[model samples]
Target chain A: MSDNLPASLPGQSDRVVQVDKLSKKYGDNVAVNDISFNLTKGEVFAFLGPNGAGKTTTVEILECLRNPTGGRARVLGYDVSKRSDQAQIRKRIGVLPQDFNAIDRLTVRENINYFGAMFKHQLDADKLIELVDLKDKRDEQFKKLSGGLKQRVGLAVSLVNDPDVVFLDEPTTGLDPRARRDVWGVIERLKSQGKTVFLTTHYMDEAEYLADIVSIIDHGQIIASGTPDQLIDTHGGKKTLIIRDAGEEGLKQLPQGLPKAELRNAGDIAIPLHNGELTNILMSLAQTPLHDKEIEVRRPTLDDVFLNLTGRRVSEEGN
Target chain B: MRSRIYTIISGHFKSWYRSKSSIFWTIAFPLLLIVLFGAIFGSGSTKFDLYLQNQDLSANTPTYFSQGYITVLNNTGAFNLHVVPAEQPDPLTYVKNDAQLHNRGQRLLVIPLGFNATVMSGKNATIQLYMDQSDQASASLAGIVHSVTVSYAAAIAKAPNHLILQQVGIVTKNIRYIDFFIPGVIGMTLLTTGVFGAVNTNGSYRELKIIKKLATTPLSKIEWILGMVGYQMILATISLVVILFFGYAIFGVTATIDIYTVGLVVAASLLFPGIGMVLANFVKEAESADAAANAITFPMMFLGGTFWPRETLPDIMKIIANFMPLTYVNDGLRYALIYAEPAQALTNTLIALGLASFFIVLGSVLMNWKEE
Candidate 1:
């Protein structure tokens, strides 16, 4: 840890963030129910949830942007509830709120420097530009940049202060697939530098790919918390054999006494695979006329884990 | 803290200068108004505004000689005559206030009682002409009045020496419409820039989550407000310098930049943005807040003596103008920049500063620096 950081309390030297039964309420509505979590030093923690799942509320609480109605939270060994500690938290943390945009008329470098000047010890704007790979567009005005380039600038701004932990709220929410991959690459660079990051996203693949530890939140409650593999192993159901483009005719042509098979969207036939049944499934399929069709075994991902846990699939729009 | 504030000021300034619309409104638009208004009204020779009070009345009507003299004066076509009521107990004071309100020269012509009797008996009759000796039009206007009185007396009674024109001096500023309008343009520019600047920065910045981003930094709400007010002061200074220079270069309108002028500028910088901040708080969306700003500033601009003198407005509009914040700014700028009336300037500046304090504090208090 840098010498600028305050001496951590006992048993919290490695913990960058600590939350105990944190709750936030707006009159009769509970935006964040009782939730406990911890973020250790140098770990990228992803808070996974759909839209309006209280992800922003909880992160804003840690950011000292909002007051929790109940319980306690600490960031960088400082209490977020205390007035003086909020200042310390502000100095040590960086935030990219949902739908952030820089000044429209300022160039990318100027915008970076503009936000950097807010901190006493800001990192070099050029370095952040290179890190976000926006050097070619450094002199371009923010309004003239593409959406992806603008998002990259936002990422650069969030790291300008050389913050202890950066909180990126839905940073890639509206980005295209390529742009999302680019932002993920930047986050990967931050991980390589061993900088702690707190990311919130409705995209399960984003959380599963970028995070060391993932917490799934629904209706203001933490439904599950573990590593991506652990959560998938615990909640994600059995793997399935997918026969591509096999319609109802393929299902009708299946061999007798086979496991139950179902026809899915796009004329694909799905058959659940139990343990040690790959060879038997393939052998039974070899005698069938549908054997010539393309076939593959797929492992369960976070999408299935969430569907299994909540009994509902979060759509692409996060509804 | 200072660096952060400076950064915010520079950032806003950069945005302002870079935007074409902002430059047009802040600099070009005001200059255009000055040129357009100056071209239209600056070169023309306006008629001397004269307030006429015919006190020589019988049965609520002017007597023959007095009525004939008034008609002769009207036929001269050198004066725009406004009739004061014959029963006005203190017509001089009334004219003084009304003249200042309308940007008119303080010149009142009073025909006294028994004028018809005195003239008919071939006795000496005096007509009172109340005007400021220092008025630029005083000498020419007095000569015309003297000529008209002698000619009317000769035509009416064939006694040219019977009518005497007595001049009573009153102090008033000799201000032209352009002189009055330049300060108003300055005030108008200040109003639009300060209010809309704040509205755009606060409303759209909030919408863009810029304020949210700033809140996560070490920068505080006070620093941000100070930065905004600082930028407003710079813009106000630029508008003042540009408009005053344009006024001087085009129409030869001169102004004095005294302490009160500075005070008014500072007050305007704080006052209008403060109002914008309050408006932004109530109306969250950027476009709606812009509409609200327009709704606020348009009435203040039209009613606050921007295009014309407020005294010419209807009684209710004048009352409403008194409550408008821009009134004091316009009046203060006129007093300080053109009229050179330090005392009136001081009064308006103090009032403007007081309002600046109230609104700025209210806005700062109401501003949502952090999310709840």
Candidate 2:
């Protein structure tokens, strides 16, 4: 993660995004309630949440599409609530909304070139199309393209202005495994180009794999923020073990002094304990009649950390 | 910044040109309508199939009265009259049923009892006119029938002994269905290009999370929208030109207004559809946007004189038509094309268009992309 972080960030001189006690309200409900966070250039920050968490609201306010109800948000040193600086901020930032949409009737090449022209320094339209690997279907209209191709084209369009900070809100929500990997590749490429990537994803794997800093948000507030490993460490120590067929008699005979234990299931269960207990648990299981049973152990993942902290899996929360 | 704006504008234009089937509807199809409808309907050879039911046959039937009506109908050449006398085996029932089933635009003229006597007695008689108003194809025939009948009665007044032929003016001569349709079709095509085509794409891109990919780029929403609009506008403009050129050439539609007025009209035209862009902000789904557009478009297509003259419509319907953008466009374009007016008063139209556009953008501003 340190290798991915720039030695000197683009907006390290000044904060690119400043959310000073920002709050967004929709009627009686608080969508983004008193949330505050800042983004510097060349940082890959992930906003993690379940579906319907105020992640979208927060992002949209920063995009200048919606106004913050309780506090102000400034993007690229321009106040978002003030309409005068909107165009300026908009010109500098690229936002890939949660949903993928482009003119379905337009051809791939047409879509790319049109979007390319929107930026301050236009990309080589043909080159951009080629970059997305949509050159083969350049003449084919948007409606004719497959979902992955459409998303690729959409990415090409977002890069049209060569923006400084890019916001990707749940970029890979509906994509299949391969298509999702393709999107990840696109992000990796953007990151290599020294662009700041702001991402929102419900997939813990995605947060763990892609994001440099992951911020877990719930009910319009940030619950936790840190590197994926740090987050997991803060929540609990590693080494989660799962064992099946710990029969009623065997369970009674089990060792009394493991550091941590969680009955994941009534019969088949998972226990998170220290590294020293493994040999003792295994030796005890061998001595008992419960031999040749399902037993597995692995390092604690981000998902385990999230569950440990929130008492719910990341997948169950708002994305 | 200026270059960025240009690039954004171009992006939209390119996207629109690439994605929208705008060329099909705006250019190719409208041109086809110009050629097809113009050739079929513009020749002034459109003859109405009329069934005349003669009910009364009495000795007291005035010789001048019956002859007078037939004379007027025959001379107008708008109708091919088929006289079905009451004495024939099947009476009103058969004719009424057949007429109803024949088609939507055919007219059945029923001459009731004491019809000739009523005319000779110098008393007003009410003739039941059954019109298939499903479309305006037979609108002129219905009007011609009414006029000739009135003239026959008038002829009787002027010359008590001899019937006189009075010329009825029906100036649907140079106008074809396509010519009549060009304005609304053009405007509708533009509306679809911008609203349905452009806005839907923008909304869905965000919805599908495609924009999420762009969220890493320097490109902004304004730039994206500008690029999109520019792309679509180019295609729209091309389509408009094709529709106009074909409509004029094939249908003999001579626009009345000068270039400046036409420019103003074209400039003002963008305002109404700007609302469509604004609506994109509020609409979250393609299905809803499509439904909303169709709901508004269908009525405007009919009531706004896309196929018929507002003057011929009922007073109430005409009044309702007044508020529609297509009504103003149709009227203004007709004045430019048909009447060949020297100059068009675009101030009011421009203002209306400006207001509509402002509201649309306003609506866009109010749209919550991430609704609570």
Candidate 3:
């Protein structure tokens, strides 16, 4: 309900889920190759990666859906490899797979209630329906819902047990902008409730807005891991000042006080800066080439951080 | 984990039940087929229409024999008999009319002039029997009736004066239409329940990626299999009750050993659906599963003696039926129905059960929870 979360509580555990050297191979192609990470309690951890980068494999293993070929994982301090401990771990975790499918024939309420019955500590049926904002369509068939509603229902299903950790693999994929924002609202609520949310996404803005700690995985290995701000401050690139002017002559004849910039277009120049001197740059641009023109100053984002670390833009690297 | 298994199973069952179209297609359609087939084929049905042209019906005619010969020939039991007196005089014209009726599949018996004189003279008299051979059963029945007539004529010739002939032998087997039909219905019921029920459901779930979600859950392969088997067992039980009642009400197919017969049918029903699971697992997709199931079921429905006697089929087809599992189920159901001998049915049933278990195990092996 609140935008700002409370301070970290005292006497909380550092790790809620731990994976050590997990690897899974399908004949020739390796899905997860000797990768490991730990998720602390009440943290919104983002698994940032391009498609086929083993983010899903790691999430699946942590959810106990997959048995790792060569590593160990524990959830809520229970060994996933042990049969007796798997049920205990699964009881504490919830998984929202990439496809986000429910039985097409059942009504929405039945779908939620069915999964709710899986765990001992499940949410009330009405409460879960309200949580997902699907109460209005509770009696509708599962297949009749739109994609966004289906995604919301999936999140509701994940929360059915009031789980310690919720695993969402590309939760906002295939959704329109509005639907993505709606899902973002749901995730924010989950974080406020102090539920650990482990999710994977290619959307830089999504990770920037929701993740407390972002881990960028590539080829089954975590290439970068830190808080979003820390990663941008350290490995990420400089903030940029984009200026659109009347002509190239005015841009090239910029004053000496302005910083060095890249020519983005004939009438536009982008100035990169490590320090926050956007006001000074704007003041200088007012008197010179960018006078009576459009100018924008922005901070470094997850895309910039990825570009700095990988030497290619996130979108370009995805392909 | 136990709770999760229960939840998943109940979830699947509830979801399937909620789909009205699927329930109709899966459960109701077969019942409709039983009613249709039973109604059309159940009663003591007649297969042909017969016509008789008697030129010498009057006892005063020289050809007329004792009154007993006329009594037997004039009797029409299971045929539609139309008698036209021969007073029109042109018997050849009468033969033409008779032939027309015969061409339309009517059994026509033409008693020519001097037919009674020949019989009274102790000579072998011939009553020309004509029928359309296009209808095979009617043609066969005509042959049998003709032979019976000739035997009657011979008996009359042997004791012309003592016209009341005795020393007759009649043998009848007391088997009803239900006796033949109930077993076939059971076989068809099991075939549909096994093939369409399991295969179509399995394939569609795979296509929808529903299985992938379940795989991610803490549910084990065995648990999933048990859940499915449990769902089908419930469906099959309901179907058995409705079908058995239908059999008795419409065809008088009494489940005489109502309890043991039920127990056997239920066991067989459960056993057969295992084959469906096997097909579902092996085929991998809905279209392929449907195709494979039809390929197996349609032939067996016809060739395995579910509808007709396997003996009527070519020897090669009968040999083919030997390999089919439904053949055993059908025969075993019949044996159980008539004699209430569960033990007599056991040997065939064990074979079916063994095959069902094989399919179940094979289905499990083929079902990869984590498919690409």
Identify the candidate with maximal lDDT.
1
Model 3 interface CAPRI class: acceptable
lDDT of 2: 0.64
Expressed as tens digits, the lDDT of each residue in A105-154 for candidate 1 is: 99999999999999999899999999999989999999999888899899
User: Which residue pairs collide, candidate 1?
Assistant: none
Best candidate, TM-score:
1
Error of 2 at B345 (Å): 7.8
TM-score of each candidate structure, all chains considered together: 0.94, 0.70, 0.75
Q: What DockQ results do all the predictions give, each relative to the true complex?
A: 0.86, 0.30, 0.35
Give the range of the ten consecutive residues with the poorest summed lDDT in model 2 chain B: B163-172
**Candidates by TM-score, descending order:** 1, 3, 2
- How would the docking of model 2 be graded? acceptable
Of 1 and 2, the candidate ahead on DockQ is 1
C-alpha lDDT score of every prediction, in listed order: 0.91, 0.64, 0.70
Tell me the TM-score that candidate 1 gets on chain A alone: 0.95
In model 2 chain A, the worst 10-residue window by lDDT is A1-10
TM-score of chain A of each: 0.95, 0.85, 0.86
In model 2, the Cα lDDT at residue B346 comes to 56
**lDDT at position A179, candidate 3:** 94
Q: Extract clashing residue pairs from model 3.
A: B63-B116, B63-B117
What is candidate 3's lDDT per residue for A19-64, written digit by digit as tens?
7777888888888877677778899999998888888888877776
